[model samples]
Target: MVKQANKPTVWFNADEADILEAFSSAVTSTQLIQLIGPSSQLVIIDEAQQIPDIGKKLKLIYDNRPDIQVIATGSSAFDLQSQTAEPLTGRKKTFQLYPISFGETVKDTSRLEAKRLLDSRLIYGLYPEVLNNPGQEKEILIEIAQSYLYKDVLQLDSIRKPSHIEKLLKALAFQVGSEVSYHELAQTIGNIDTATVEKYLDLLEKAFVIFKLPAFNRNLRNEIKKGKKYYFYDNGIRNVLINNFTFPEMRQDKGALWENFLISERLKFNAYQSRFVNTYFWRTHDKAEIDYLEETDGILYAYEFKWKDQKVRFPASFLQSYPEHQTAVVTRQNFEGFLGA
Candidate 1:
């Protein structure tokens, strides 16, 4: 979009001291115009959440300079949304950029090539840097996981103990593809309360580090309603958190990694295609479970992700209760269609 925009486009990265100073001092639309130059037809502010009164400033620009287009990008969503929500309510369009998806890789390369790298992707993940740097995925993932992943979460005033957040993240990483309990997480992290666990988890989610999938329950009394499973936005980050980059064949948690990879990629697929769907994992107290569920247009779809070609049978109880549904098992051999590739 930036490349296709008009000439004389001004790009301001808020991370730079001078750029931050200029934006911080631009109190009015006229001042902002002068700072950005009146000749500029498009303006882009990266790390926009770092600038104070950004929403109002953007609003001023929109109201005064109808000729210029302004684009704001920020990594810390909680900060960005809170600052921009009210002032830019009717003035802005928001977009989320996720890690590289299977569909994108297939588009860039071919479905055959993407399929060939499935095992590597499962272990190293689909992060752009990791994907681009084939041999140095472990090192890059380690750097991202350690230095960049928790940058936003650590900056929040609500976060008092940073160590607890790391421990909690490690715990969640280990338990991927399984139900998570805040109380159990609290105990696992030690010295943390369930409320703090929940709060940190919420912050992590806002930071796009992890996402929660709640139990799918409707008419069935035996369905586990309050249960939730948390999956990382990127499998690389999850694997780095646990310090595991072992090949899928050598890893004991290959099943978990496969589930995490498919679900995360599916999430990116659904979002990119603008599919409005509710996602969940279904499990009953009696141990009948479906790996993943998507409800769209009043129709339920159940999916089971497997690393190997294996017989998968959707619990009879689930089939009987939700008769109007579709089911499929996604394996490496047949996952391209499932991921919209």
Candidate 2:
């Protein structure tokens, strides 16, 4: 974006306590402008969430200086959004960036290479570092999952029992590709209430650890609408939680893993392309279900995931109710289009 704007760039690390304190302690926007000096076209702030009152500060700079554009980035949105929500309401545009997507990777590689890398990607995930450092993918993923992913959330005041956060993550990890019960999760975690479980899950999502897909329903009596299914933003992190990084062929939950991989990559594609859509999973009391459902522009697109060749039939009741929608089976044979690859 800096290069495209044809502007000289100035960068700052908000994570540095000295710089953040000094900059934020400035009395006014005029002082900030003087501190930044002249001829600065673009100002990029890394880990912007760490600095208190950063949103207001950025807004001050933005309102005062029309020539300079500001870009703020952080690992977690929980802090950043809370601080920026009201202050930068009209001044900012927020984006959620995940690991590399299939749509992006395919652009640089041939179809055959993409196919060959599918298993490795599904196992180790699409993190840029993991994708680039072939020999150290496991180490990198473990370090990220343990040390980097939850750093922002852990620092928040709302988190009292930090250890429970990891426990909740592990429970969610085990239940991937399946509907989650908050009550059941609370029971499993012992001494924690259902509300805390929910809060932790929300924090995890804001920290980019997991995302929930709510059940899709049309108010049908038998339609399951109360629960939600959670998936890790990265399979490598999920694997770290479960402590299993075996080859896909040796894993019994290959289908579930494949589903997680596809859904996450699909999400990344949707986000990067700015395809605004409401996503969900559909199921009925009688066990009829679709793995993924996406609604866009008042049109429903349903997908059932399969790691291998299998006969997948859409629920008859779903077809009868939503005849205007489209349904397709996604599998290894023809998943490229489904993933926008």
Candidate 3:
């Protein structure tokens, strides 16, 4: 039988100075058990990566106390995953929580209102604080970009110079919709090798700041295979990296911003609803391209994102190769359905 919901729950934040001190001393399983009393039905440990040997400690609790449910959360994937991978292999189930999604905003208000705020969403993004505080988006984004964005990556021993990561992020920010080359990035961020650039990119990805879209090239000889494009998990973060918070109408990269917004929101939409799909960008060496592609259950879906309502024609080469596919152009006027709202 499961524990009833009426029982008490215990919460601990390993980042808090007092909690850190207490956890640092509670080394043994017995000591840890004493710290978390038997009366609690649930134990929640936030910033669990800060606790030493967290995985083994969690395993011990699971082994000893069969009644009490435990939840451990960490902001940084690299630290948390590394610490927990070995000890709590089968004992844990992980879930990723992204920034607030378009569907969620619609739930809070009406779909019409969500559409009305589309420009603001594109400029300021949908982070909880940014959404809650209407006019303070710029200051909040600046703080997040400078203070918390690289907090985890900078702490790693492998990252000796922080400037390289900053430069790499700026370069990625500038090339949001375009294919990125490691050699070119290395040349741009002087004194850094291609290997380090790749490493920093990986770290940023693991940290959930950005995601990569690989080229789809299973069919055509002209399709570019060895190409990758990066998009931020949030548009505001990308803008803050390059210090561009211009309104959508005034910006030159409105199309890129729109593409990033659609892709990221679509990511959150698919994730929340458990729609499993493999994603990519389609491009040919000769410059014909489709902005985004998704393959699900062996069916291809191609999408082209436009900031304004416009007719778009997908590449003929791609259509000929993948004949049995769905295609659509997602525009500002009809983007609500694209984001699963």
Clashes per candidate (backbone, < 3 Å): 0, 0, 0
- Candidate 1 lDDT over residue span 1-341, tens digit each: 13455477878889999999989998988999998889888888999999999999989998999788888998778788889999998888989999999888888999788888888888888888888888999899988876766565788646677899889999999999999999999998899899989989888888889999999999899999999999998988899899988889998999999999889989998998999999999999999999999999889999999888999989999999998899999998898888898
Best by lDDT: 1
Better of 1 and 3 by lDDT: 1
Instruction: Kindly report which residue stretches of model 1 are placed more than 4 angstroms away from their true locations once superposed.
Output: 1-7
The Cα RMSD in angstroms, rounded to one decimal, for candidate 2 relative to the true structure is 2.1
TM-score of each: 0.96, 0.95, 0.96
Give the per-residue lDDT digits (tens) of candidate 3, residues 143-177: 88877676667885467888988899999999999
For candidate 3, the TM-score is 0.96
Estimate the overall C-alpha local distance difference test score of candidate 2: 0.85
Q: Give one digit per residue, the lDDT tens place, for model 2 in 1-341.
A: 13345678778887788878877786589987776656788888888888778888888888999788888888757778888889888888887778888777788787889888898888888889998898998899888876765565687656777778878888988888999999999999888999988888877777778899999999578999786999999998889888898989899999889999989988988887789899999999999889999998778999999988789888889999887799888888999998888
Clashing pairs in 2: none
Give the Cα lDDT of each candidate.
0.89, 0.85, 0.88
Name the lDDT value of residue 125 in candidate 2: 87
- What residue runs in model 3 are displaced by over 4 Å at the alpha carbon? 1-6
